[model samples]
Target: MNLGRYIRRTAAHQPDAEAVVCGPVRLTYAELDDLSNRLATALRGLGLIRGDRVATLAANRAELVVTEVALYKAGLARAPINARLGATEVAHMLRESDARVLLTDAAHLETARVAAPGTAVKTVLGYDGPSELGPGYAETLDGTAAEPVEVDCAPDDAAVLHFTSGSTGKLKAAVQTYGNRLALLRKSVMSADTRIGPGCRQILAGPVTHASGMPLMGIFFAGGCAIVLPRWDAEEFLATVERERATHAFVVPTMVNTVLALPSARDHDLSSLRQLVYGAAPMSPQRIREAWELFGPVLSQGYGCGETTSGVLFLSTEDHRRAIEGEDEELLLSCGRPLAEAEVRIVDDAGAPVADGEIGEIVVRGPDVVPGYHNEPDLTAETFRDGWFHTGDLARRRSDGYVFIVDRKKDMIISGGFNIYAVEVESVLHQHPDVFEAAVVGVPDERWGEAVKAVVVPRDGAALDEAGLIEFCAERLARMKKPRSVDLVTALPHNPNGKIDRRAIRERYWAGAERRVH
Candidate 1:
């Protein structure tokens, strides 16, 4: 099977249609088909064969999307690095993935140039123009013919080296096979709530190298427009939707929080939005309600990670309405049920299915699930076993199949012999009108072994104190689950993917301690 053929098919049907748009750059399907074809041919000309890895390190740009399609056409695996990653991590991933080619932009040129020397990277193509690294991206593709090159790949052929640092700050790649990626495309367009068709436009608001880029293939397969943002700005995102008449958008919770904080959010002409999907992190039920009010009844929550390729569970726009406007209020806390082609089960420690409403680790077995992490056999065996990938997210499966994420397995706080989930407490803290952001972490304690501590960022101009916040949580949460102490901060730390960094908050209180846990 080959994915590139779909691009050619779409181009044949609507060659003059806009395929991608970023700032002043717009590419018609004809241009997209030609560029990807030329680039794929050029890569083959570079002596790279099937399964060879190509890495990309750049900010959000149209070229990144082209590179992904080109990699697919050539039967090559892609390893995309987030631009925010430091040089050390960049070098580590380059070596880990054994990437043969590095395509980068001027902002990250120095890092790639410096890091590629000792690794398997043979060439570095700059996005802006030629540098000492190699020729410009356009120059490389220009040297090749635009004739189509579709490499036949097996279902198990390596397609993507999906890398993530996660909470531990260690980068690892999930070996996503061709079949897994094809499953992603199938599921993306199968659901009416998320399907992108002709005359539809999607704004990729985050870094296209990761979560935001997941929809590109589905959009292309259905002949839709992908409007990529050159950079992320909350107001610009809203304005682009108004200007481009974008029908769909995918953003993380941090971006949503920023957009909701804008005083002029209501001033923008945001009526054209049909589906505003948010994932990669959780947004509290309160924020979900606020978003529904502001963005209308078009909010979807996706739950999955790199190992799962993309979202396996999606809380559709209708699910949001059922929770907010209808009687199923508890559904607001759920991440929703499994989508097509994915089998999701909440299992106990022994790898057996847990009873309904009992918390367990989520295990998924499906075409979209990556086989295992690259070069980490031990970890691979630990996470992917008995044909199911064990997601370390602790969640409870409702009888209706909705999954409620309680906490990351490692983030659960055992204080005074009672297990307290940080997310449960954070969910309560989010209910307070004055709280803008909150992170719950287990801190060292003399008697309780671990005490629940909360770090909060209050709303602008809203008066709040540690005592008041603690009292608020105590009113809603059980006494043992409520925060024993609170620290008021202007902002909570965030990892690269824009989720609140709970690990960083716990580090401050655990410094110089004998063990991480009390």
Candidate 2:
């Protein structure tokens, strides 16, 4: 089934149900569908044809959702540009994707115009506000028909060309198919009986352009209400949760850490949040325990990459219970088991399966896995060897079958002929009572090829010196695993998706290096 079909089905079955709530604006399923139909008609009038690409450069608003639905309904693929990207990066993506039209608001109009100067973008639609482009956004369907255009879309048709964060290097577009998206939604619905129902509120706080936004479609598929936040704020997130009575919400580890640090967290009434899913980065066991204490046992974890439609593995509620009860320390470090219709395995460098309790590259295969990258054939072939997508993550599988991620292939540090996983060091550092967040990276060393460095953010008003932190890590970890230097900061840099920007941190140390990986 097509991704656009979700919107149509929900609109038809629950026409009056609240589909989206952004700030003061709220749209019913019927309204959302009709508005998308109008946008589709407008796009067609601008000479957009089947298979043409349309790009959106907006925040998490109703317009962004409408643009995606309209483009899909008209048999056009939609590319949602990350609002945090620079002009040159945005332009490169537009040119690479061959976007035929751009839908942007006043906030990003100049950036969009500068990016695609003379590309295939023939028409640009602005949001409803004053801008240099003229008065405001215009409706192309004043009295036009609201019926959806009948365009043929197969499961193999490219539905989305989403760009990755480019942490390794230049951003690459991941081609998503109708089948992949359908598989994700189907899995989400059947995973748990706590399905989103009519008027069930969902909070959208993460970047809508990222994979985190994919699950929001599942809420739409289940005829639920989505509360969109333009950006995430600690207090605002809590307020929205309380005011909207949101049932489901997704946030990265950084966001959760920020919310927990808020002084008002204890004062806010957040009883409405039922399922709080956290991923996109590793969550410290200490932080998880504190969150469980505050938010109860409703927190869950999802693990996946952009290459996968969204989530391939789910750390279920029962797993959280096991962790809370101190059943196993390894379970807390795991990203949990694979979801239904997914297969996960750890393989060695030669693609041979590794034995349990051994570390190797994590490979996944499933219906939600994308066929390949958009245009990088060589990269696609290299990544999809032997019918499994190599995740570039080092992981070890316990005898119990739960996978524990060691570190990224590039993030591993070798010092004095000893291998060190940054995650292992960071996990130990976070166990300290004074440390709020920590990131471990390798830096140049004279005696050793590399030395482990810990960048930490201390708990508010808590005093943590470098010597004390080193001593704390040394108490629990081996001498070689201890950090050589500790850098304390108020907050760690984060990417648009809210994950710690390890690339940025590495670049500071390896500015002139030829290779990023040590």
Give the winner by TM-score: 1
Scored by CA lDDT, what does every candidate get? 0.91, 0.83
343-367, model 1: which lDDT tens digit per residue? 9999999999999999999999999
- What are the TM-scores, per candidate, against the unseen true structure? 0.99, 0.96
Alpha-carbon runs more than 4 Å astray in model 2? 129-138, 141-144, 512-517
Q: Kindly provide the TM-score of model 2 when superposed on the true structure, using C-alpha atoms.
A: 0.96
- Looking at model 1, the pairs that clash are none
Give per-residue CA lDDT, model 2, range 1-518, as digits (tens): 44777798888998998898888889999998998888788778778877789888887787777777777788888788889888998898888789977778877888976887867776677775645543344544564577786466888777889788878778888888777777877877877723577767888788777765777678888889888888889899988988888888888888888888888897877788788888888998888988888787788888898788877777877788887897775578889878878899999999999999899999988888889988899999999987899999999987877889999998999999999999999999878888888999998877887899999999989999999999899998999999999999988887766778887887788888665455
- Model 2: colliding residue pairs: none
CA shift of 170, model 1, Å? 1.3
Which parts of model 1 are misplaced by more than 4 Å? Answer: none
How well does model 2 score by local distance difference test? Answer: 0.83
Query: Highest lDDT among the candidates is held by which one?
Result: 1
